[model samples]
Target: MVVIEQEPEEPTRPSSPAAEEQAAAAAGGEAVRPSSSAAPEEAAAAAASGEASRAAEEEEEAFEDALTDEQLREKARSQANDAKAEGNKLFGAGQYEEALSQYEMALQIAAELESSEDIRAACHSNRAVCFLKLGKHDETIKECTKALELNPTYLKALLRRAEAHEKLEHYDEAIADMKKAIEVDPSNQQATRSLFRLEPLAAEKREKMKEEMIAKLKDLGNSVLGRFGMSVDNFKAVKDPNTGSYSVQFQK
Candidate 1:
């Protein structure tokens, strides 16, 4: 079992468009201009061409107005670290929804600031765990997938995704993932034990299904004997592969 650390709650709401502009301004950049109030089709066409140059120019002006790229990147990293810390706090308090929000913020900042694979993997895995707590199996799977794609050797991502797959009744996929995780981290007792449990259950299920099929075939053969007014001992049974059925022949 992956020991997921809880994240903290988000300290504030998401930054609005206005806030994003303000942040840019504070950094010496201008805010992005709003699109014109024309019909969407017309606006899209305009935005597609030079007509949208005005917005681009406004954004450029903001960029020129802000601090250096290095400074902006440092600021983004700092903000992201703050969000990550908050997420950890929320997770500790069992506020999964709030924790997930903060993790998302941290991930967005990481993407923009550092392109740091490690931080991105952590945030994705954290969000996946939060989704698991919220009982959102599909979303958990998605987030875990993202984390794994970022770092294939990420043990927590593999284990958590396997759990989510089990919740979805995709047992084979779950087993496959767990096996990979075990290969990566042989010291993980939880992964090893989970594999142990799944292997036996899978074998047992197959055995049970085989037994059921055999019992069904026996009943059908007996019914055919009764219809022929003969006991099973009085006849020999042969299967016709073409029709997939047994034919009884009178004994010599």
Candidate 2:
């Protein structure tokens, strides 16, 4: 035989003074009078205030419980859209900081809602534009990255991030973003033009970096070879054109 477990009963609590007074009146006994009328009035007011607060809390809980998930999402979307529209207006007016704040508000409102990724991505991209307008290239890149993380195919985010990278002289990163943007929208002239412009800059930067690295290596080699009564210049490196390999030779 299986025995069922039972919940323990709650302990009885003592009644309040007002409850006792009402009980006494119901029992045909005179209620004990308070020292001052103000005391009872204050106590009654406090009780009423507490009851109203509890009632309000219950009503709010009930209302929230009554709403379907779709209804809540729709409400959040509407709010986010409103904030985003305000941001656009501010951006048009050249109030970049204010526009950023509005986009932030939109992001906050939509962040927790299910299926709100598009709005969140849009807000992040808008914030990136604001940062770009304010000359904050790093922040623009960061916000655009967040937008792209939400929606990798977001053309505006990709373009904005590419622009930010270009501002920071990050030619390779700018070229990569432009390439991705072109992949997303092949017909976009802006991305196509940006990719064309950035490729040359990236190539030049790569060459410059290669030269700098080789110069540093030469300096280090000279430092080590000088102790042996020799210099790096005394050695020559010859490249085999067909094999694409280099061989070092010792010279006087």
Candidate 3:
């Protein structure tokens, strides 16, 4: 008889770690190890990202701390001064539209400031001049009104509103504003001249209104007198210009 040796066969179902290990070893493989560089690279990336975030926050805080309220106001005033200077130059050159732009820029800066009321008033007054040049009477009046509200003694604003009122046929309002302007500055020759000029116009308007009232009253009187065979034309009131008195007469 010949002697023969046979190899052991694999188990149909694994029962333990030894069996699994043997199985893996039989398949010519081993357990994996942690990566050598991946963990370090990941950690370095996280640290860099955190540092960048912190740096951004610090930069924002520094920026905020750099400018206090007073400092910002000072900066705004300085810029407004420059804009006003530029606007003055443009206005002197008769470039009204361009001057208006510079004045508007000054106003924008002035609005952001805390202590530039005079500057704001000046900007509005200058804009009123621009609107006047542009033939925008209503806009001029509105701008001057804003300026006057800021500085009630603004002579320019008073004069401009008076002029606008005159143009719009508001004679009484024009005279009132002119009187105020004169009252505010007694030595203002322009206001005095304007007042003198407006007085005659106001007088004429008043006389015309009186005449219109008399005419309407006469018409109503005539309607009533028609029932009695008489008319308002039969009655007359004559004024004595010297004494400023009137005398009534009736026709026979």
Candidate 4:
């Protein structure tokens, strides 16, 4: 099962002309001296423009520098939440790729927010859902693992990761993840059902693997024995039921 989180609406930041002007000024680099052929009025206007641009840049920089750490963090959280909310909307619209990009943006912004682990984890989990929808099972597992790293008890991440593992035929890993999810939320029927379903699959896979290994070993034994005019059929492996151990016996 895949789960996406919807972030609460946060206050939007007001557009600042100063910030836009600062960007334009930076991009312009060294201001071009009003063409030497320009009029006196034009030169004066250019000079005024440069001074205004510098004043805006200084003002913006000062405003940024004056922000306390907590305020800065709050701003980052709001920005991250905005990105996450956009991703959720894109996901709901069935645009998984676009949603993935927004989640990536959220993660990048939230990465340095020490108190925003929940946001980080939710973004990662949302990205995992995108991957899952896109049939990128490996990427889904990676994203879910990242979410789980940030919040180990994240049930959605565990369940989504288990689903990814199952898609890749990694029954044991799927079962383990489902078990962890169940541990994290004992009342989760989904996890309990998943665990029940995965257990048989894991057991079947293990048995199949064991049988394949035994067959390969037999082939190897036969190859070596053939050189001595013998076959693997000349030996028997008997199991001691009490100790669950095997005993190799020579046979005619």
Candidate 5:
């Protein structure tokens, strides 16, 4: 997710003394300059407005004082890439926690710099990889989701999310992500292989879910029928495989 600071509300644009006096005259009150020491509310409002402007100026200056827009963008991208590179190094060294911190730093810098969408997406994907390594499957899914929001065609994010789904046994989601990955990169052998492998597994999960649903319906039916001194077991459907038909039968 893109990070942002909540800005202080803009106090009503400061009214000029002439405008304030005109409003006072219209309201049948004596026009008087609001003394800062005597009118606490007016003073507070003015103070708040000034503070808001100053804060905005400081924030703008912080970005503008150092570099031009193009230069700032370049700096942000470079800094983000550096952090990502360091994170990769830590990940390769099997320091998952440290890697995660570096990836997070990359994300923060990218946000502060307002880096490109690709940079944000890459940072998010790298963070997801760290989560995956740490066995935080759900967290990995969340990070991948953010990355995909930034760049839906991000192949690494797609695969990472798919793997996280697989870990959580969300077979339908895993298969869907893998299918999308394959669509994006038709020649991706790993995606193709995963799709082939997970298809049956997903199908099996679906079959199992169907059986559970059927069993639940049966139980509900039995409960209702029991109230009438009957049960679902009293009736049966005998399939005629040859004719692809079923014959209803009743137990005596």
Candidate 6:
């Protein structure tokens, strides 16, 4: 027999050494190691991604913290402006009541805002105009007074108050207010013209009453038959039929 001696049986490898190790590692829940050459880059990539995620989180937190109280106030002011715009639209359309409500709400909001005096003055003036249009003279006067208090030199408020006084037949008060307005702004032609127009009517009416009173006083003081002035018997009166005029003959 040729080379009858059998070579020693080759050593048998375990059927699945790597599979068993993976199963053991899986059971133990330990991370598997990557190949040594690629491991550093993979780890660096993971670290970079983790760092980026953390940075993004921190940025979001910082942005949230930056929303300040002034921003909130500005937001409120913007909303008030929106309300005022709506009111202006309605006022343009001649919807006085609706516009008044919008303006009032806007004014309330504006009052809470800082440095809103101008807007408040405008609101008060607008409300007064609406009230005047509605024939609410007292309310109009009240609003105008408030506007004047807010801004002492507000010409519109002064003019409107004078007009309200005029409407109430308080002529002297109206004249005084108009005078003050004109003093403040000499170029105000309306005030000047109003004074010119009203002053004459007032004077004329007073003069007419005074003339009537004087005539009554003369009649009461002098008797019709006073001897020095005249006697009915001594005075002769004649009526002319030829002319429409009556002729009176008197002896001196």
* Model 1: lowest-lDDT 10 consecutive positions: 1-10
Sequence-dependent TM-score of model 4? 0.70
Q: TM-score for candidate 1, please give it.
A: 0.56
Highest lDDT scorer: 4
By TM-score, rank the candidates, best first: 4, 2, 5, 3, 1, 6
Model 4 ranges with Cα > 4 A deviation = 1-69, 242-247
Q: Each candidate's TM vs. the true structure?
A: 0.56, 0.69, 0.60, 0.70, 0.66, 0.55
Per-residue lDDT of candidate 2, residues 120-213 (tens digit): 9999999999999889999999999999999999999999999999999999899899889889988999999888888889888977886697
Q: Write the per-residue lDDT of candidate 4 for residues 93-136, one digit (tens) a residue.
A: 99999999999999899988887889999999999999999999
lDDT (0 to 1) per candidate: 0.82, 0.87, 0.87, 0.88, 0.85, 0.79
Compose the digit string of candidate 1's lDDT tens values, residues 1-252.
124576944444337986765556645745445556678998788657655677788788888767577787888888888998899899999999999999999998899765678888889999999999999999999999999999998999999999988887667788898999989988899898888877776666666776697667667767887886765566566778998566667774
Provide backbone clash counts, one per model. Answer: 19, 0, 0, 0, 0, 0
Order of quality (lDDT)? 4, 2, 3, 5, 1, 6
Residues 94-132, model 3: lDDT tens digits: 999999999999999989877688999999999998898
Residue 191 shift from truth in candidate 4, angstroms: 0.9
| Cα RMSD (angstroms) for every candidate in the order listed | 22.3, 14.2, 14.9, 19.4, 18.2, 18.9
Write candidate 6's Cα lDDT for 1-252 as tens digits: 113576854544446988677657756978657545657889899789888888998888787767666787888888788888888898889999998998899899998889887778878888888888888989988999988888988989888888887788667767887898998899999999989876876677666776687567546545665746655445444556887344446667
Worst 10 residues of 6 by lDDT: 1-10
For candidate 6, report its TM-score: 0.55
Question: Tens-digit lDDT track for model 5 on 152-231?
Answer: 99999999999999999998899999999989999999999988888899888977886697678779989998998988
Error of 2 at 161 (Å): 0.8
Q: Can you list the residue pairs that collide in candidate 4?
A: none
- Model 1 spans with C-alpha error above 4 angstroms: 1-67, 205-252
